[model samples]
Target: MFIKECAGYELEKEKSNTSEDFFNRSVVTFIDGSEEKTLHVLYVRYFDEFIQEFTPYQQDPILTKDNIQVTFKDIVALVCLIKNPGLRNRKRLYINSKPEFTSYFQDIDFDKLTDVVLSVKQNNKFELRSPLDYIIQTR
Candidate 1:
């Protein structure tokens, strides 16, 4: 399936005093068709039950007509496998891995996601499908 469009991001921070130290983000690329399928740049920061615990803390405040688009955390596990150039060129994750790298999604811009999609596809652990892939509902 072709990933027609994509987006995913996080605008959060810990209890910090000043905003300078706070974390910010930049957009990534949207889609591609180089070799293997390419998933967006969505990833997880933790493993184990920590994921379950870390979730409820996400922003859910319903204010000023905003959205709470969440990006699942497994995509990080998939990234860890793409560090090496050889593996990346091969388009597959062939090393010890975790189960969390199974499913995830988000609503980020193309800039912040393109590199990730390229890297992930380079390692071959993701499935880049078009939004229609789900909307169409094929068996």
Candidate 2:
């Protein structure tokens, strides 16, 4: 499945704020080749904190929404290095190292999401590659 759309907004903060207060709320929608959809609401934060707690074997942290909690893993995908020429590029270190866990989707224009090429997760690795390469590799 590829990302069909991604939209987000910053959360409000009070005068007295902590590190946790700095985050954005995003909703990502995925569509498979057969047109099935999956939606995920993400609370986006700094990558440093997320990476510190990340481990492949451990269960991901639970997400709380409307008083309900759910545990889920972030989507792991490959983004085309050449798409979205108008948007600012992400840092090289963040491009291929980890999954799209923390800052990958931060501050991006949701409308331009469809202008870029995206690959669905077929495995646990992420890399900077052309969309065609991703499809060939997965096949």
Candidate 3:
């Protein structure tokens, strides 16, 4: 089910021009039969490349129920999930990195991260009434 949903998201991403439509995409999973958690894996692309480039170590792949190996991509995806966009917009937002992967992100330059996030936010803007308004007005 999760794999299928990921495939669907990939298809949508390929067909769309901007990621704004998927900015709020997330997955909810049950924990301990009584608890639930929401994961924003769809935002993994925001940190994928940067993490991959900076980290030389990799975690041992774990096989899922579907027999899929969860590799570095999955690790990065889990780490990058933005639980609260509202809180993230603030001047300082603390994110806890998993102990195993702490070294991978400990050296991140916040200024660069902020610039990247701001750039993504700026580029993703589109008029809600008409998605093509910017394109039309530019001509």
- Per-prediction backbone clash count: 16, 0, 0
lDDT of 1 by residue, 1-139 (tens): 2222223344365556544222212122222446433333323322322434423223322011123232333223222222221222332232212343322222222233433444443443334343332222335
For 1-139, candidate 3 gives per-residue lDDT tens digits of 0111111132145455665543323332212223333343334233333444455443333223344443333333222322222321233222233343344344444333333233323342111222122121322
Tens digit per residue, CA lDDT, model 2, 1-139? 4454433444466566554355544433444444534343334345324633542223333333344322222322212222222122232211323354534433333222222322222221223233333222221
What would the TM-score be for candidate 1 when compared with the true structure?
Answer: 0.23
| Candidate 3 clashing pairs, residues 3+ apart or interchain | none
Error of 3 at 97 (Å): 16
lDDT for 85 in candidate 3 is 27
- Model 1: CA > 4 A from native: 1-46, 51-68, 94-139
TM-score, every prediction: 0.23, 0.28, 0.30
Q: Name the lDDT value of residue 15 in candidate 1.
A: 54
Q: What is the C-alpha RMSD of each candidate to the true structure, in Å?
A: 15.9, 15.4, 18.1
lDDT scores for all predictions? 0.31, 0.34, 0.31
